[model samples]
Target: MSGSRKYVRHLSTLVTFSVATLVVAACAPTSAPSGAVAQNNHTDSVLTVGLPGSLSTLDVAHEAGILNYYVAQVSSEGLLGVDTEGKIVPALAEKWKTTDGRTWVFTLREGAKFQDGTQVTTDDVLFSLDIARDPERSPSTAVYWAEGTQVEKTGEREITITLPEPSVNFDWTVTASGGLWITSRAFYEAAQSYGSSSDLIMGTGPYRAVEFQADSHATFERVDTWWGKTNEKAPKKIEFDFFSDESTRLLAQQSGKLDISLQIPASQQPQYEALSNTQVTTVTDRSYVGLTFDTAVAPFDDIHVRRAIAYAVDRNSIVSSVLNGKGEVATSIESPEQLGSHIGVESARSLIAQNLADIQTASFDMEAARAELAQSVVPQGFSAELLYPTSIPELGTAALAIAENLKSLGIELTVTGKPVEQWITTLGTGEYGLSYMSYTPTTGDPAEITGWLLGESNPARYSQSDVRQLITEQAGEVDDAARATKILEATKIALNDVIYSPIWWGKNTTAFASRVLHPEINSYFFMSGWASQIGLTDSQN
Candidate 1:
């Protein structure tokens, strides 16, 4: 993945909050009773969903936002797919294996056909991979395919891929999360604009796009000829209505106008939970929200200054007061869910805890912060500005809290909110001293974010030879435990440097009507044809 833009596009709208008072009023709800279901006694064959943001395009290649992936996955699929548990599973490819980490062999699923009734040829897979790896066509995903990598068809139903170097987690590159969506060569070549409303793309998934109006709505229908087994009781039609405003989505859901609402803000969780016909599900998604410093710049360039800011911010209070206790205070750059991809969740947590036990983290100590600042190049505190995305108001709230804390150390921290697009550009161009950083992993590999944060091309412009060396060693380390240890080692160094101050790992909220029954819901649920996995509840049926 491109260190600058790949993961940035997946920044979710799940944590929007305007004020701390609102969060306090919307206290966390008690656990729901077992077997609880929505009580809206309505039967409908269409599943209408409201998305918090508008889709600019259905083109996964050109615009691969999280929402775009959710819609595109309905009809398009990659060689691999991520299950609800965040494990890689077979999609276009029925099975795959590799004798050496560099070379992989895959067997295509037999008799799989696209929605157009044409067989999913090996040529289609090869073409899709080519597009995915082409820098011009897919700049965000091209990094997954190293230079000099090769792909060829070995048989009618088999293909082989050879990477320039060994990669233990290369399989993640072929999954939807990695941005490789397969489409027939003929269809792509014939279309004037692939994935456009007039020429929407096609794939072998359970549903086919029937209509799409940019920034308005997109409609899809179930494909009876789908090769994979689908829920017989699943809705016949899925309609996605875009609502850029969060309140509109809540209103739509409350008015019985929507069956599902994606990206429900954490502040509104209590309101959604109060709905008798709705169920609100929140999961700790694979996302990291933090404070990032341009280490190459002055003041922040001083490790003592960086460490002081880290110690000043109260992460626990931010998560509870500003985030409504929906998220957990982050301990490292990578989320526990991302690290747990190799080891179990508990094991990942234990590994992080064990490694960070001796290391000093920014634990909200004003006295420690002042002492560190006193030892910096500027013994007296300095002024700096922190940029946050205006769309996510909670980030602004967190920034204000941090700024207030910094005041105790004689630091004047200015908090400013910018449009998300401009904020991203400012961060990328190194135009700001301090900024709020958010990232959602594009791949399940634990090394994904770590490599970006510590590697040579890290956005922070901070580099350490030891950390870079460990990152390189872990990329090709086939042993899961060993690779994890290497990553943890790198994480320890980064934390010690305080280039990035960990804030909170985010939680994603989704509201489902009582009539809908989903098999599973998690960070990875939208990576595949999730709509096909949902059906009407037994009571509604």
Candidate 2:
């Protein structure tokens, strides 16, 4: 490891679904208002974003908090883009390359200035990586970056990172941000006693914090000196109104008090679409509900037991009811949405047509499932425990259906539910037998899944060496088409091993008023947060 990076203690590993939405929104700007509306103390220009959760902090080094996702626009800058269409475009660094198989170099653009008017340099990049790689740092994405990866300030205009391996999908890890984007060293040093309650944030993006009320709400003003310039009608200001209830957010929207609402309750999505002033655009990044078993434990230790559980779940019903038939029932982690370069269908043979053939009409095949369960190593009868996060509605509904379906298979089930935080904590700390989890695609990168699935340090703890090797091979293959093929094959191997029973992915939908334009939407984050290039049109959801 070099100065740019460090080996932190084992990361409580793995990035989850919300981290995806939080990242890009962080890169955009939170501002006061710009243009025509600025003439008024309150302009039509204020883009008031409402989120269901609370913002914990504006600092990226800390929690990749959902609320911070709203204010990230005012906090950070220069990200490697994973655009809305699943394309990896440039956001901060103009161009970058790799060397020595393990070392990667990024060339910073010359004129790019921080929000403070100081030009960006290798030091800023090194410090940012240091934040991510620090054990004391509160990075939500510590797991992926908490390895033998190192970063160095090679030159004024460039930085380099040397990983332990060739890491073919290394760029994808950059996309799997745990909120370690660049921050000013001066501001960071000033905010001492770095605790959960600390009031400290310094980002190099388009906006600066004029007021941070914490939890309840906060406000930001545009930096007139931001380096990147967008043609969009950038807002002069941005405000986030935090509410625990979606009704409060909806009320804000109805009263013409809000310009953008990142989320509209599922039931309200249809109504939002009907409103002439709002527009709804659907974006899908893989968000599948899965049943993961602790293979290190009994029965589930048996492949037969895992397969039986897979057969017991009625995924088709989940697709129709929960997902509104918008997403297909997925059997494998390798989604078709991943760019072919990262996930090739050819290598995923066993996981595809053949493995999925029986699942196309997946149902509660109680009799067959029972027979399979009966063959497990359990002596008399086997009882299965199902754990799920209460915050995720789909998990509860899916768990109930599964409990009922699994009962038909003669396997008694104990469904345990906990709030998202407790449930995730329990997962990493070991408090459940089987759990419901979701994954946010780091990009369209299929190879990205390899790390989560097979990495030795995976919180999921899927310790299959063959699966690990296959994924490792896929990532290191330099040839584009060949890499895709290896990725597909690796996916097939993992699925054949039944790491988890996949359900349905959520269709990402961003609802905004007609006046809110150029959201900078992508699989990762909303680009609208960056005040520089964003333009607001009289647009709707």
366-395 per-residue lDDT for model 1 (tens digits): 888889899999887889888765545677
lDDT of 1: 0.73
lDDT of 2 by residue, 1-541 (tens): 1000000000011242111122232234233223332111246556677754444455534444233433564556544545444544455666667654467777666666676677666676677677767757744555556368888777777778788778655654553232346666665666674323454455666776766655567777677666555435667677877665666666666556766666444556776566556656677544444666667767677877777787788878877876566566765654555434344435443335544564422455666677766787762457867765433445566678888877666678887765333344444334555655555443345545445555665444677667667666756677766765555565555566776666765555666665655544654454223345455553121
- The global C-alpha lDDT for each of the candidates, from Candidate 1 onward, is 0.73, 0.55
Q: Model 2 clash tally? A: 46
Q: What is the lDDT of residue 484 in candidate 1?
A: 86
